[model samples]
Target: MKSRRRWRWRWEHRGFALGLALYTLLLLLLVSYMLDYGARRGRALGDWAWEGQPPPAPPPGEAAAPPAPRHEAKRNESEDSDEAGPGSRAGGKRHIYLHATWRTGSSFLGELFNQHPDVFYLYEPMWHMWQALYPGDALSLQGALRDMVRSLFRCDFSVLRLYAAPPGPRDPLAPFLPGGGGGGGVNLSTASIFGWRTNKVICSAPLCPAAPRARSDVGLVDGAACERSCPPRALRDLEAECRKYPVMVIKDVRLLELGALLPLLRDPELDLRVVQLFRDPRAVHNSRLKAKQALLRESIQVLRSRHRAAEPRGLPRRHPLLPPGAAAALAGVHPRQQHRAEFFLGGALEVICQAWLRDLLFSRRAPAWLRARYTQLRYEDLVLEPRAQLRRLLRFADLPSPPALEDFVLNMTRGAAYSSERPFLISARDAREAIHAWRERLSREQVREVEAACWEPMRLLAYPLSGQEDGDRQEGGTVPLQMFV
Candidate 1:
């Protein structure tokens, strides 16, 4: 009996060991499958990352026929010709970069592209980049900025989310919830404008399953699952849309140095075109000053409110120059002294003129190949002759001028009136009046100061000298073209 019991126990142990081995094999298989699936997904995402170099030029005489007369035919012909090069045909899309300075009527020019049915327009995607690496903080930021722009051109906005994340607990705003939540909770609405704008644009697109959801709730569900699912899916949708559209346009005023972006123009995959929008330097300076004055008033009000709040809390005030007692004293000072102090302390107008000069110099020095792809448009020309100028711009961009384009120009400027005060909005009424309105607003001394600071650029760009030039000459005073070089 003892021998039989030993034999039975051994058999039972063998059976248990066999089951354990089988389970281990099954777990290994499952893990392997998951890893393979992830690899596949990653590969798919990378396929849309960048279009390799452009295709070699066709042999002489092998080029496609010239565009036909009909608008649709011309569009088709352009597409066919573009396909001759690999870079241009990468998913079949054309790209435009609208480079401008602040207060240059760029907002209105951007709207022209935004209103197009066939165009996928992005407004200042680099705003996130700027916020991440605020201009003067780092000198090595250009490479990173260029990479971000390249990703965006290919419809990969996932990188922008990294910059859009909320600040740490130490952030002043972190303690208050704008939506009535308790302290230490984040307010999605106020966290990052870049994120909010990105979310709005992504959710508004047709492919987002979460399109109906509110902007705050987007990509926040199911923890990591939503984060993983939303961006790739939206990017895939954007890629498909890019294939359908003939052109993609990105506009930004922060790209003051055109030379930094020349590399992108040379990229085969980008097929990039540049529209450099400039305004009269004096006008830009005047507009910037007006904006500063308005901002100063708003800031003064906010400072008073903060002082009122801090007094009850027994907290120290933040503004060194605007102490509670000093606030009243400031009102009695001359407005000109106040303006001078603001500009001197902030280095505002000087920086503006310097930037204009820097950008104009960089544009002038661009190489021949880069210049071939570059087109310059004046804010005055655009506002004064919207239809004609826009038509020229469209042709330069290699875009067909459909009836919709004409309607957009007309409708954009028809109802609104010009106002030096409202710099942010598009005013379609009286383009010529708006063009020369700076003459009436800016003091002669201020104009001369601007001219002295930006003499080379002002002369190069043909902006007439204020009050010093012949009235009969419509263009700015002539300087030797060699001076620009």
Candidate 2:
């Protein structure tokens, strides 16, 4: 009996030990799972911070939606303004922003809208703010830029006077003079508005006697004649003309971040829609290289803004060499100094790519209102299929796609010859040559640098990496949509 009791006790202890070992194994797995989950959650939160919003949680048991179809991604026109704020009303004028950086063919894109008779288009209105506040970091100037954009959309041209006026003891005509009241500020007028010479509205009828307005008018404006005929008009008169149009569009390169424009996006009265244009970074880099001298100041501002953002608040440091008044002196920089400008401009491309990545990621995770109000466009696609792309653009802006507009787009892309004489000139050009020109113009090393710096956005934008055939033509690649709407 004593022997049987000892064996029974030993068996009982062995059973308890076995159960504890199993429990410990299970506990380890639970802890490991919790750690992994925490890591994934942290990464997701970091990404959401880019856009300032977290994506909505998925429903239980729902598989994640597949990547958006090409057409769905491009066709983001949301007809229901139910989500649009209280200021939204039926039949309100549509406001559009042609969001692009400098020299991405934005001038040509804006020209398309400018030629539309029913549209009132302003080109680079923020240019006044940028020029007025030169040496101000781009990040610091965003508030003023946003305000200017908001006011312009409302047809309150008076806001321009804040930046447009000569900085010294104010003279109304100071903006018209070569130097702002002898302070050497920008020369401003209805005639001096960026791209005003090519503006159909400014060049036609009520604004100028150069050409009579016609419903079928789709020809490029004769900029020389327009400059000769159109005199400076009062701000109030410009506003009056602005009011007559059913649609208002502004093209700007100064607004760097999509998040910066959220307030405008939320404004119901303005009913803003954005057509954000992107170009291959390699091409943009090539173009910037060609126009480096002209773009130096802007490039400096872009770089300084990025550097300033990373500093602790109130650090107050500025580039020792780049003083507020030093911009005027860049024109005389010695040949050796040109390398410094090139280096600075190269940094600017990185800033631009960073901005592109931020905008793209934000748009992808954006809420319904944002998704509704935004559209993404590629410069390559625009030139490759002008007619189809133009129709889609007009559709997004609620404009009619007329035959004259079609003809205008076709003729603009097919020119007599490729010319770099007027790099910034808005005229017909050989589209194919323009698209492939960078291949020959950029050295292999230069191409590699641009690709290396911009690889993230290049991938997201579907641009093929160097030496790869365009994915659009490759197996398993998407076919370009014949129509977006």
Model 1: per-residue Cα lDDT over 1-485, one tens digit each:
89999999998989899989999999999999999988764332222212234334655664565533322331233334433332234443578999886677887888677655456677666666655553332123444666667776765555566555455122221122132111112232222222222233344444345544432231221222323334333333444444445677888765434555655776667778888887877777666666665334222322232212211011222222332432342343332444643454234434444445555555565555556677888777676568988888888777766676676676655545556344554445556555666778876556655655555556567665544356524532322222211
- Candidate 1 achieves a global lDDT of 0.53
Clashing pairs in 2: 180-185
TM-score (all chains, Cα) for each model: 0.59, 0.71
Error of 1 at 349 (Å): 4.7
**What are the lDDT figures for the candidates, one per model?**
0.53, 0.69
List ranges where model 1 is wrong by over 4 Å: 1-89, 135-140, 167-243, 293-355, 358-368, 414-416, 420-422, 472-485
- Tens digits of lDDT, candidate 2, 1-485: 99999999999999999999899999999999999988764432222232434333346554355433322221133434323322333245778999899778998899898888778899887876777788987777876787788778877766666765544223322344233332212444565465566677677766665464442378876555555566766655566666656688998898777666766676656778999998878888888888888789889999986655532122222222333432342334332333777788888888888778777766776676567678988777787789988998998887788788888998888887655566766789877777777888987667766766676677678776654545344321223422213
How good is model 2 by TM-score? 0.71
The best candidate by TM-score is 2
> Distance (Å) between predicted and true CA of 472, model 2?
7.1
Q: Which segments of candidate 2 are over 4 A away from where they belong? A: 1-91, 167-189, 210-216, 310-338, 470-485
lDDT of 2 at 146: 77
